[model samples]
Target: MLGPNGAGKSSIYHSIIGLVKPTFGKIIIDGIDVTNIPTHQRCTKFGISWVPQYGGSWSDLTVYDNLVAIAELHIKSKEERLAKVNNLIRKFELQNVVNLKSKFLSGGQVRKLTLAMSMVKNTKILILDEPFAALDPQSVRMIQQIIVSLQMFEKISVSISDHSSRDLLSCVDNAMVLSEGKIVAKGTPPRSDKKY
Candidate 1:
């Protein structure tokens, strides 16, 4: 579902997570219609998670604290929650900055942290907008590797939008292009159209 700026990708994400009600059409996950379900209820049932372009985490909180809170909220067992949060911190290479305030993180770090938080509950479906925005080349490559691993190992369904064709091609098997809030083309996107 990735596209260029102002392509309504965020809008679509919000609608799916129930933050913004759809003006039309149905949102179905796992063969169940959830268009009218409340956001919290949907979180519990469908394991749907979203990381918006401009929102996530408590800025004043340390990276570790923020993830701890998210893990507590989503995971039932105290031990399991702590284990998962620690695993993600290591997986995303956040140990160096785990105690730093989220506001102090570089854009790439924040994006990685946000992605980690979105997977706290092992969500089956994830919608991420601009997941690699403001990342350096190395950070981008690291995130790409994590995403590819998630796809192959977890079989999680992810819809991510990026301006770089390499980002999408590195992780996605399919692409859908949108214009003015409507789908214009649906097919395999190549590595050449990086801006789409």
Candidate 2:
């Protein structure tokens, strides 16, 4: 999704995640109606995972612990939880800060951690709202790389909504422009492909 601020981009994401209730329209995913389903059920039953704009983190928990905690929610075995957590730690390149509390992580690292956290579940569709916001150039590039990796390597469908259309142009295969809560334009996004 490509939209200016207040274009209802975040609202759409929230609605899909069941954070905001829609007045009437049905919410369908993979040809199933999930309209008005609770957020937890939508995530667990529908294979949807979301990362909010500001980065989702349990500030007091260590990087390793954060991954473990989320994994435990879905994976039953102790060994499985540890295995998944460690794998994501490696994949996300957070080995050096594994024991450090998430509150102390840099902005980019926090973003990476949240991405790892989302993968703890068998998520098929990933929703990222305002992913490129409030980051330095290098951090933006780092996040972009991870987003691409998640989509290509993990085979997860990604829906990203951001006001920074230039940054996301190359990242999205299809794009929609929203204005005043309605789609104004949509198609394959124009590629900027600027080297970061």
Candidate 3:
């Protein structure tokens, strides 16, 4: 999703993830209406995962510990969970700082850890809100590449909201522009010079 700030982009994302109840219309995921489902049930029932604009994570925990915690909450079996976490850490190149406290890592490293944590459960839909906010151009490009790689390899449905139309459209297969509380425009095969 490509939208200007305060366009209710995050509101829509919250509604889809079951964080907020929709006033009307239905939220159908994997052919099921989940608008009434609870937040915790949204993940298992709808196979969705959400990472907020801030790149959700535990600031006090080490990178590995944060992943392990989320893994435990959403996955069963210590051995299986550990293996999966380890695989993603290596896949995302997080091994070098996996043991460092999240507060100690650079902005880009923290973003990577947050993304790796989101991938722990193999979700069907991954929603990221304003992922590149405050990121340098180089950092934003790196994150975009990682997201594209994940989608290609895992075949995961991704929804991303960004202030930069160029970044979001370039990375996503589809684009939707929202203004004030509604979708203003939507298209596929994003234009290189597209602007929101």
Q: Which candidate number has the best lDDT?
A: 2
lDDT, candidate 3, at 93: 78
Model 1 TM-score (2 dp) = 0.90
The TM-scores, one per candidate, come to: 0.90, 0.86, 0.85
Score each candidate by Cα lDDT: 0.82, 0.84, 0.81
Model 1 stretches astray by more than 4 angstroms = 190-196
Tens-place lDDT per residue, model 2, 116-182, is 8987888789998877776677767777777787778889899998886778877767888999999
Lowest lDDT block of 10, candidate 1: 187-196
Over 1-196, each residue of candidate 1 has an lDDT whose tens digit, in order, gives 7567788888888888899998889988878899999998997787778888975989999999999999988789988989999999998889999999999998888988998898788777777788888888878777777676677789877788876566777667788887778888778756564332
**lDDT accuracy of residue 76 in candidate 1:** 93
Best by TM-score: 1
Instruction: Name the 10 consecutive residues with the lowest summed lDDT in model 2.
Output: 187-196
Runs of candidate 2 with Cα error greater than 4 angstroms are 190-196
Tell me how far the alpha carbon of residue 189 in candidate 2 is from the true structure, in angstroms, after superposition: 2.4
